[model samples]
Target: MASNIIHFEKDIEFSKKVVLNTSKKFPDPKFIFSETSWKLDQFQNLKTKLNFVKHKLNDFILEEWHEHTSKMNPSGLVVNHVRKHIHPDFLTQAWCKFYEIMCNSSLVSQKSLLTGNMCSVHLCEAPGAFISALNHFMALNHQSIKFDWLAMTLNPYHESNGHPDTVSDDRLIFSTIDKWEFGPDYTGDIFQPRYHEHLYETISKKFDNGASLVTADGSIDCSDDPGEQENIVMSLHNYEMMVALNIIQNGGSFVLKMFTIFECNTICRIYLLCCLFQSVEIQKPATSKSGNSEVYVVCKGYMGRSLATPYIQMFFKSKNHDNALLPLSQIPNNFIDELYNCSSYFCDLQIKTIEKNIITWNNKNESYKEINEIQRIICQEYVNRYKLKPIRWDQDVISSSNWSRARNNKRKINISYSEKLRRRDLCLQEEAVLLYQEIVNFSNSKTNECHEILWGRCDQVSLNISNVKYCLGKPVIQVRSSKFCNDSLLQYRIKIINKFPCIDSLSNSESRILYFKTKLNYSKNGINICDLTDTYAKNRNNNVILQYSCLFNILETLQQKSEDFLLIGYPLYTQIAVACFFVIASMFDTFAIIKPDRNFGHAFAFFGFKNLENWLNILSEVLKYILPRNDSYTRSKLALVSWLPIQQLVKQRSHLDIVLLNNLCIAYEVEPILLSFIQS
Candidate 1:
């Protein structure tokens, strides 16, 4: 390619001017890059070091430059003038002031540290605030402590000079965190970012004196003694260059400012610190809104490993540190689906409760089968609440250079309704049959016929004998009531905390079910001298003679993690029919939503769990209820099968049964799904 020459002349003048200005401001606030000093253990001393008026003028100049560069950006998103008032000089002054703040004050506290002071590193998704806060603190007065901030000052003077339009718009201004070279450009801008030179020097001094921020790497693991560290604060959200978790210590308290990470992601993080910290407390800051970037803190873990090691390292394959330097690559091809299909992305997680809060079931239905169904319903409700639009599958979220050109010439896909209905009807058939088989299996086991009969099910599945479209109507479902009934301990309690039948509940049903027993004395006559079994008789509510074989807690898990109503893509009629038989093996229900999240989890964990006996049974019941599956109860085991990945729904359309269940709920006072189910 031939090169153009008009760019050189313009750039030369700007570069020269920037150098001249840098030299003039260089002496305004004399900076110390030495190893030893008095009243110098913190950045606060650096603030008092600068000349006020001279430093102010220099700060003003930098802001002016930043404002000019923003206007020159390719994507025309500039700060709103009405509220932000971001001018070039204003931005520069902001950066300098931020640096002065970083220099003079401590964003971290001694209470936040132990024998070693820990400096937690955070990235700001909105970089401006990061710098602004630093400036406000630094340009003003000293706090009790000062932190080393690596805030950036964009090189605005380079604007209009006609440089190559490569990525590198963001530049690091002042901070002692790192060298501040260009890493991945997360969102806003990640072009040619320049960093400060004296950071390494300042930080090294902190280390030699053993007063550095936190412990450095594995050799200094202290997750067990968090009360030792100072007050912890997490304010940044953009830079992924450093291991944010490593910046703090074990048992250290925290003020985390989280925005988009999912509840699961948070759980995973805490799980990693399980060993290092005795207890972990996670909370959202009051200053945050449900719609804003969310925040939460991981009470510091002090040992070699925390309680959640497995969960923390559960995700993400190793990405090389060297490769981390590339400017955020087109948001990558894989991130879009994860935003909603699996976990939270950068978007604010808005937890929506109905205008009228969700109802709490009053009736107590403690039957074994019904309680399991309630858990299924809760999970479904969550999915519906957070689910996003379907996305197309691709290696890269952004169209490749070649893909961009080809996409414009590509064709669209289409399908029909009659075909969709036929498919769903077949699914309903399979659902019915699977339910009957489980009843037969439990009856045939000879494990106390009363046990089989006492565990009542199908107590109330509202039928729609009318001209309705889908659903068995609303089943006043035993699952909804079983979880809260008084017989919970006798029925499902396992551990002290698991008594509520929830993995995280206060007490488990399994652990409490076997508390009562009658001691027997052996006579010389042996069996001939045995006494009558009347002593074993008691209130069913007072004693639960649980048959462990009959209850593997599988049903309980399904109640928690499964979805009774599955949504699928249109044209997936074949998949729907197969879903009927899968009921027994899947222990999952089928509702017909056809979306990405359902499809992927279904495809991935289809048979991945250690115990599917209960899942298979519940799934069999769901298929029997939803499909005409009851007729073929003795047939093959793949009744609930669906080769179609739920991920495919990211491309297709459908609905989940829980959402339908919710619709049935809102209409419970009016039309009741149970009325429709039984009547039909």
Candidate 2:
């Protein structure tokens, strides 16, 4: 009985905390007594006390809440179990997850900081993207943002920031609100309580410190008032034409829910924000349950003249609410990387940075790749000298041309070896096609197979490899920095990433292992595959030794290849997200920069980790410093790391040059030796 009483007291206390955070203390006591407010306190003093109680409520819920849940709804676990299936739009899903975790009280306490310093407003409006965020928050953690007079409120969701795209504007709930007599329902302005207290007080004050909403004529352009650069202010939705015309100092953010009404004015407002803000990205919150019209937010940085940040002289409220950016300039250059290198953009300080530096990109400049004959020669010499043999699982590599000829030769009745050779030669001249449809099916079929036909001028063949299914969706994007690919191997890697978000940040090491293990499992017979990194490193310093000992007597493969890489005709920077790296002819022989053991060491690391593991990490750092804010170098770095597959390298174990050889030896467990001379 005593425990029960204590539990009751705890519940009451938690209720108070929720009340305080969700609502604001109205300065006008008269407004609180109005019919709009009841049961909940107009001022949140009691609610503040309750939140302290609820801090402990978290522990209590974890320990005892489940018991209450089990009793309240027996078979509760199975009854509500369902998978949330989201299709495509991986970036939108990412943005939603960031908000869901950040905004929820259960997941993150108010006192702690969040990643990316991203911020959001529960736009006082209803049924829009803001509400969608709220619903997502509730669905993810089961904590609804219980509101003011929720039960008694009529047409409460009229101005919400969500709406199904298919629904015509005529059927909108607001359609009726604007035209008909809706009884004091529309009178509940979120800013009403504060308006009675202070007019000059910034919107931040009336923010309910939760989410605030405003309804303005959509005809006017929205902007923060530049005159009042005192404190940071943001509008979740921008039907308010005066938002941008009346903004606070740095670190202000605004999400404008707009139609394509004022194209010129909209462009001007956005352009100004881009100039003042650091990093800016246009996003559509696809995860929003409301699926409302497009939301374009213009976020700005805090504007306190700071020597630390001379660029904007911006100052943001620190975690402690003090003038935090005063010493921001004192931050070391090295530490600067950490601050800028984050995922979130809608937050406080970080948002300001992103807003100011936002770049509008129309095209990506492909990395310059001039054929280096010296590097090619060096790579060849290194490989030849190391003598590392590629895994010989297949009888021969299906060169770009031979795939069709082999198929045609098989079709001819008992064709002679010479005739087969002729067909194989002809296959090289044929146009590339996914011919598998003639003998196979495409999407929606039960199996994973490649079935298109690329009929060439000369040859025809079927790529009926069994491991195709596993290869079908390897990379959500292509791996290497290549232009185009017709190879089945290339196609598989490209499709894989395009399908799976989990593989987005995978490193070369991880992707390689995944490919090999998957292929090995699906292969007709289980084969003992060789470790590429180890093999290459083992014979790195001695190319000839590796080739002669580990490989069959296939002579002059490298020596005969053109010294000028320009002649080889390989594409540049093959889709880095897809696998398509080819050694050009121009690179000097024995010019391997990364050793196998170290560069492709684990074959199971994420892209981030792989870059950091190899010397490539240093190179990436350089690119980060050099590339513009919107450049695809970061993506390139990621793709480069994902391109190296464990099996691909292990199967093609080749020798490394001196630089790579030394690194490989050290990586593959070589001991350092000191040379000392003793005079006799």
Local accuracy by lDDT, each model = 0.24, 0.24
Least well predicted 10-residue stretch by lDDT in candidate 2? 671-680
Q: Please list the residue runs of candidate 2 whose C-alpha ends up more than 4 Å from where it truly belongs after superposition.
A: 1-124, 135-241, 244-252, 285-295, 298-680
lDDT of 1 by residue, 376-446 (tens): 33223322322211222231112222221111211121223233334345543243333223323432342
Q: How high a TM-score does candidate 2 get?
A: 0.20
Residue 200, model 2, lDDT: 18
TM-score to true structure, per model: 0.23, 0.20
Question: How do the residues 1-680 of candidate 2 rate in per-residue lDDT, one tens digit apiece?
Answer: 74465345333312211000111111221211122111212112322332233233232222233333232221122111111222111113223423322232232222112221222332223323233333344333432333211100112222111111111111112322331211121222322222211221333443323122222212111212211111112221211323322322234333443322111223223333344444333433212211112333423232221211222111111122122211322223332232222111212222222222222111112211111222233233322332212222221112223222111111213433334345445431130122222112321231222211111110111111221111111111212211121122223333322332211111343455445345224233322222334333344333323322222111122223232111111111121111211121012222112212212332211010111122233223322222112213112211012223322321222211221222222222211110000110
Best by TM-score: 1
Q: For candidate 1, what is the lDDT? A: 0.24
